[model samples]
Target: MGTSASKLNRAIMADIHRLSLNQATTERWSVKEAVEGCLRHGIPSIGLWRHKIHEAGLRESVRLVRDAGLHVSSLCRGGMFPAPTREERQQRIEDTLRAIDECAELHADSLVLVVGASSAVGLVDARKMVEEGLAAIVSHARESGVRLGLEPLHPMYAGERCVLNTIDQALDMASPYAPMEVGLILDTFHIWWDPYVLQQITRAKGRIYGFHVSDWLVPVPDLLLGRGMMGDGVIDNRTLRGAVDRSGYAGPIEVEIFNQAIWDMPGNDVLSTVVERFTSLV
Candidate 1:
C-alpha cells in the first residue's frame, strides 16, 4: 500500500462515518419519509433537494430533520448563470440569493451550484455570465454563513446543465473569492473520467466543501439519468476516496444516483440498498 499514515487514518474515518444519502436517489420519497428512511437505514445525514423541502414547507422540514437527528449534508443546487438577456441574468441572481437563504434555513453544510449553460451563447459568453453571477452572490453567501459549492458537472452537461465542466474550470471560477466563501464539490460520477482528477483533488485540499460519490455507467443511456450505484459501475472509489481524504476534506460523501430504474424501487428498498452498496464499496 502506498498510503501514508495520514491517508490511512482518513480512510478509516471515511469508512466508519461520513456517508449521506442524497434524496435524488429515491425520487419519490417525501421529506418526512426521506428522513425516516435515513433513520431506518442508520444513515446519519442527507443531501436535500429543493422540491422535497417545498413539499413539506421549509420550516417544517427543518424541524422534522432536526428532530430526526440528521445533518443536511448539502442543498441540491443554487446556480443557473447563463441567460440570453441581462434581466434574466439578474433574475437568476435574485433566485440564487433566495436559494442561499434557503440553504441557511435548512442549516445545510453547503449550497451546491450547478451553474447553468446557455445554448444560445458561445462557451466564452456563458462562462462570463457565471463569473458575473458569482460576483453578485458570493458576499451574500459569506454573510449567511453558507458555503457556495461550485459543482463542475460532467462535460456532457455543459451544453445545457452547467458550463463549468472540470475541476480546473471550477477552481478558476472560485479563485477570486476566499476559500471559505467559495469551494468545489468533488462528485465522483462527474469527475472520475478526468485523468488529472486525483491530482486536482489533492491540490484543492482544504477548499473542498462537499464530496459526492456515485458510479458512471458504461454505455451510459441517458446523459443525465444514467448514474450507476456505487459498486455497479467502472470507478474504483476506494482510490478516489483516498484522494479526497488526503485533500483534507472530512465532509460526508453524498450518494446521488439518477437512474430511473433505481428510482422506481420502493423508497425503503432503495435506502437499504444504498446502505449496503456504500458499505461494501465506497
Candidate 2:
C-alpha cells in the first residue's frame, strides 16, 4: 500500500509540472507577488498579463521570473484588431507590436490574442479587419521570435469583447500565416460547448500554441467574470487536454479562471485549490 501511494504521489507531481498559474486567476497579485507565490506552491510555469508586467516594470519582471526559474507559458493578450477608424486600427497594430517585443523579452511561448469586436461593423467586416490586422503584424511577430496565439472568446462576448468566437474561425484567420508565425489558443471555457471542437483541435495539429482551462458555470452571474474552477462546473477538461496532446501541443496547461468569488480569496489559497482541481479534473 505504501508503494502504491508513492507512485500516485509521483504521478501527481508530474502533472503539477505541466500546470501553470495564469496571472488573471490571481487578479490581486502583482508580477513579483505572483512569481513568489508560484515558487512557494511548486508551480513550474506562469502566464503573464501586460498590466501586471508594467506594474512591476518589464526589466524587473523578466529578472524575477528568470531568477526564480519559472517558464513563461504565454503572454495574456496582444490583439484588438477591429476598430472604427483606420488611424485607430493602425494605433492598435502599433500597440501589439510593442507587446510582441515584451513577449520576446520575457521568452513567453506565445502572445495570446483576444481579437476585438466592433458593433459598428458587421461580423464579416469585423473578421476581415482581424485578418488584415494579422497580416500587418505577423511579420513583426516572426521577426521577434514570438508566436501569435488567436484566442476565441465564447460567443456571448461577440458584441463587445471578442469577435473571434470559435476554434474554426480562429484557425481560418491563422491559415494565411506559417504555423510558427501564428497559432490558436484553445480555452476550454470558450470551446468546450462546440460540437466540432474536438475535430478542430485535431486539425490544428502543429498550430496549437496554448491551452487554457476554466469551467463554465450554468446560469452565469456576470457575462465577463463568470468563469469557474475546473470541477466547479460541467466542462470535461481532461478530454480537451487529451485532444490537444494528440494534436502535437506539448505546452503548459494554464488555469485561467475569471470569477469574482475566486478572486476575492487569498492568492495562495487560490493556487492550492488550482493544484488540487488540476490534478483531479484537468
Candidate 3:
C-alpha cells in the first residue's frame, strides 16, 4: 500500500471499535440473524429495531446478543407522543414505558425516540404532547436505567414523522430533564441540512446519547425510506461525526440506511458494504 493508503487503513482499523450496525440497515434480518451477522463481520455493537426483537422473541434476542458479547448501541424506537384523544395520548405514554422496559432488558445504551408528528392538533400542541409524554415516561426510564434519546427528523418530516426537526428543537425539548434521563440522538441524514447543526451539537455537549449515520439521497425516492448509504449521497459525514466527537459522544456510530435497494441486497453483502463505507466515509 502507498503511505497514504497505509495510514488510512490503520485509521479504519483503529476506529472499527466504534462501528455498529443498525438492524434496519439489514431490514430483512431477524434479531438472531442480525446478531450472528454482527459477529461474522467483527462488528462490536448493534442498534436493534423493536419489530425484529419481537419477531425473535425478546428473551431470545437478549440471549443472542449477550452470548455474543456484543454491545447494544440503542433501541430503534420508543416514542409517538401525539394523539387526538386523551385516552389515545395515555396509550402512547404506556407504549413508551413498555419500550423503556425492553431497552433496560436489552441493556441497550439508549432508547431512540422518533417522536411522532401531529395530525389532529397543531404543531404547537403536538410538541406539548411530546413534552407531556416525556414527562410521563421520564421517571420510568430513569428508574429502569434507560436513557431516552430524542431524535430530530428533517423538517420535511415535521408533519408525519417527527415533530422535533432540528438539533436545537431536540435540545430544547430535552432541556428540562437530567442529561441521563433524556439526551439527543444525532442522525446525519436528518440534521445535515440545518445551518446551526454544528452549533447545536456543541450545545448538546454531554447530552448527546447516540449518533446515527446515513446519506440523504437527492430526488428522494421514498420520503421515509430514502436514506442512502454513507458516501452514496450528499452528506459530509466526517464533519458531522467530528462535531459529535467534539461534543463528548464516544459511543457507537451506527450505520442506519433505510433504502429499499440496499435492503434487497443479501444481508452479508450489506454488512460488508456498511463496514467498508463506515470505515472510509463515516
Top TM-score: which candidate number?
Answer: 2
Error of 2 at 175 (Å): 0.9
Candidate 3 lDDT score at position 140: 92
Q: List, residue by residue over 1-282, the lDDT tens digit for candidate 1.
A: 456967865665456468898999988899998899988877899999988888989999999999999999999888898999999999999989998999999899999999999998878899999999999999999999999999998898888989989898899889988999899998998889999998889788878999888888788878888998888889888789889988898889899999999999888888778877776687
Q: List the residue pairs that clash in candidate 2.
A: none
How many residue pairs collide in each prediction? 0, 0, 0
- Give the per-residue lDDT digits (tens) of candidate 2, residues 122-238: 788888888899899988899899999999888988988799998888888889888888999999999999999999899989899999999988888788899999988889999
Q: lDDT value for candidate 3? A: 0.91
Which clashing pairs does model 1 show? none
Ranking by lDDT: 2, 3, 1
Q: Relative to the true structure, how large is the alpha-carbon lDDT of every model?
A: 0.89, 0.92, 0.91
Q: List runs of model 3 lying over 4 Å from the truth.
A: 1-9
lDDT of 1: 0.89
| Candidate with the larger TM-score of 2 and 3 | 2
lDDT of 1 at 34: 89
